[model samples]
Target: MADEIKNTENQELDWDSPISKDAGEFEIPPIGEYTFTVANLEKTMSKSGNKMADLTISLDVNGQAYVRHDYLVLTSNMAWKLASFFECIGLKEKGQELTHMPWDKVPGARGRCKIIHEDYNGRPTVRIDRYLPLTGSAPAQATAATAPANDMPFEV
Candidate 1:
């Protein structure tokens, strides 16, 4: 048997009460890098009918908390994006090919990534530009080490 759900259509809302103007406002974050934590993960289908994982991530910018959604569409051409998601959540190391993704471990995982603002449907919106290595993670350290020597004779 399924649990009964209460119907609230007839319930009246307190419209006369004062509400904060910024309570439900969504602000487009500035284009830059930010550390984010996975708040939720839900399996869904994209508009194109492809299997997709919807991720709700929480991030702080300038001491303000914000939530953003990222979609990981399952497809052959989208494998790279999926891999990046795994790497960002610490499920797999960067450059490590994975055949399976452990979705259960994603929630509460923290990672870093770049965010960019772009025009979508004739409106300005922000989105995840690319996943990045955590600041103190091994991949970040390796990248720093592999950087070209600043004293090189020519620009790299």
Candidate 2:
């Protein structure tokens, strides 16, 4: 069906045309920090039934573009991760508190994140290790380079 395939040109494909198999496998980027922009966000439920925000982020590594998905599961266990993400996206300052999350403001927001390679289901994959403060917009209390290792990125 025309709607089934995600063709870049948006044209209907010829059913009998030979398909190209030259598409190569994805190459995982090196582990490190990279600048990322929020491509999309969907509020959903995680596998364990916790409320979550699924974030699609576009990463730029030395001029090459990569994409990765990260989830913010709203649970006490994942609070630190959520805080870091909010801080990285400029939603809140380090140690600041918030009564509500403005989810609409997340799309198009830019930030920094650390990426890592790991095995998931026996297949190699890349994942966002953690979020970092955006460059040039460090929190008033501490710069990115000086922020403590355990610093929380959201309001308590």
Which structure among the candidates has the greatest lDDT? 2
Which candidate's TM-score is highest? 2
Instruction: Give candidate 2 regions above 4 Å deviation.
Output: 1-17, 138-156
Query: Which residue runs of candidate 1 sit more than 4 Å off their true CA positions?
Result: 1-16, 19-25, 138-156
Give the whole-model CA lDDT for all candidates, comma-separated. Answer: 0.72, 0.76
* Tens digit per residue, CA lDDT, model 2, 1-156: 111111132446788988776965566778998888787899999999999999888787777667778889999899889888988988877888966888888887888899988887676778799999766664232122667757879856
Root-mean-square deviation per candidate: 16.3, 13.2
Q: What is the lDDT, from 0 to 100, of the residue 145 in candidate 2?
A: 64
Output the TM-score of candidate 1: 0.70
Q: Residue 156 CA error for candidate 1 (Å)?
A: 70
Give the range where candidate 1 is weakest over 10 consecutive residues by summed lDDT: 1-10
For residues 61-140, could you state the per-residue lDDT of candidate 1 as single tens digits?
A: 76665678889999999988888877876778777777688987787788888998877767667788888854455322
Clashes of 1: 0
C-alpha lDDT of candidate 1 relative to the true structure: 0.72
